[model samples]
Target: MIAYSRSIRGIERTEAYARTHPVNRYAAYPLTAFEQTPIAGTQGNRKKKEEAASQGVYSWLREAGQGQKLLGELLEKLGRHNGVASKEQLENSVHTLVDAMNRWESAYQSREQLLRPEIWEAMTLAMRHPAMELLGIKRGGQEVGRRLVWDPAILPQNPNMEEVNTLRRVLLGSEGLLMDLKRALSYAEQYTPMQLLRQPFIHMYPYVLYYGAAQAYHPLPPRGLIMNKTV
Candidate 1:
């Protein structure tokens, strides 16, 4: 009985080791060209590649900043919750965001120009889903997806509690979206694009899939949580 238990433990340990270090399973085979490269040389090459990729993203981001600014302003206006703005104001904001998206797409077709091939391919695939849409661009005289729109009926002065709650929910959702966007932009600015690739897998949202991964390393708690910590 003791011998059987020991054998089982050894087998389990060996399996776990194999799972964590997959390359060890192929130790009997001769090293490939890539495997034969010196560790330092490989790392240096990776670093350079990452730096170049990050620079591409950085330049694209600078141009995308205009869209981000517009979104931020809209978020701020909604946050105030005084009352719904005129239809013209809301339409203007939407049009501006749409134009920004079109400009960004035209300036650098992300599928062709951004990030490493695999990264961009994955992003393109992910962005095609309907749920993944946010301020989608106009492509070839057609709209790809619709941007977020606030409920015009919701207002602080409204007597209906349900409507007020609905507005709160919308604002909260919008805040979350804006926060993720800002987080991604900030991360790309501070660290290499490779760092983003290393971040833990989260959602497929552009913000989360790209720059938002950095949020795992530098977390910013909510305002209420921060206040609680101070107390």
Candidate 2:
């Protein structure tokens, strides 16, 4: 009976060890090829590639700083509630956020200003998603490029082009901004998760997906404007 109990405990310990093991996770988030190699200036051509890769890393770090700051602000707001939130106060708070969104979205359309905060917040949320494991898509050559790790299934199959177009219009259209704002506020009230901040891999996926999607979809800003790191 003692031997039988000891065997069961050994199995349990093995299982527990497997559950916390990071090998699988590290496999999922493999380091970039550039990260794998030492920068050798002997060849000279590789030096330029290394420099560009380092710049990309710095840009991602900056964006991460912005995301961390935004998340801290959100957490502070959540902490103040103390399990009691007044409807009027919540409405006013949401209104303020929506108003800011309005200004940024408008500026983006006109190419007058582009705001990175929304992108930062989106990155934060994507990284905190429970399934976040990988950070980048495999690219040819030595440099690694980040990619969003969402399942393609997250987007509906045969998504209605008309409805999708309408949604995009609602989000980007000035005339429809107020309606979209109201809907977003309502959704946030019901579904926003505050506990994501406590997750183990909260910081990893955001840097991957945010810059990955940006590089993939929007490689450059609007015509006639250079890159604006400030906005």
Candidate 3:
């Protein structure tokens, strides 16, 4: 299993710091007063910008939520099967997951200011390796067993407080599921489905617990709040 002790400790430290230093009231409104209130003939342009920003936020939340849900479903399915899933099923699930991730990433990129820069950077980096792995799996054949080509620039960065904690919990849970699936794929190649059946179900309680806790946290901003800002 991928050890998350370091990540967890980092999250705890960040949370403590956040407790001591609260976000500024105006941090959420990055736009200047002039930008916030459209002047004269710029009303039409400002209206379009607000609409786009609103849509971007909506898309990000929708796609991110869908990806999380799909990840949970895949984990539950793997737990049920004892990590003996067929390659085809794994490929399909990974494809869907990657697509949703891509959509959300695009949405987030369009509105990076919606989230704290540190949080956005952390999330993007956290997603890269798994996304590469999942894409390789989707391509099948020699790709599935290939080593990850770690990017030198993809180093870990500090995350902001409660949101960071929620993100880390979700990332760890998803990473565990991805690792399990990759292992199962390897086993499938060596043994027939019948032979794979004898393998014991890997306990997935930790993944389930992490995912459950992250869900309870609701890291994303409320839709109404986001809309209000755009308006």
The lDDT, on a scale of 0 to 1, for candidate 1 is 0.45
The weakest ten consecutive residues by lDDT in model 3 span 193-202
Between candidates 1 and 2, name the one with more favorable TM-score: 1
Q: Where does candidate 3 stray beyond 4 Å?
A: 1-39, 83-85, 112-119, 128-231
- The model with the greater lDDT, 1 or 2, is 1
Candidate 1 lDDT, tens digit per residue, 45-111?
6578667666766665575466557667866765565332333443454455445445554545542
lDDT score for residue 225 of model 1 = 31
Candidate 3: clashing residue pairs, number: 0
TM-score of 2: 0.24
**Clashing pairs in model 3, backbone N/Cα/C closer than 3 A:** none
Of the candidates shown, which would achieve the greatest TM-score relative to the real structure? 1
lDDT of 3 by residue, 1-231 (tens): 357654564435656655544556754535544444534445786688657655654554455555556656766654454222333444455556555545544555666654334424544455445445433423223653332233312222333455334433332354653443333223223433233221122234344545666889846443233333333
For candidate 2, the per-residue lDDT at 192 reads 25
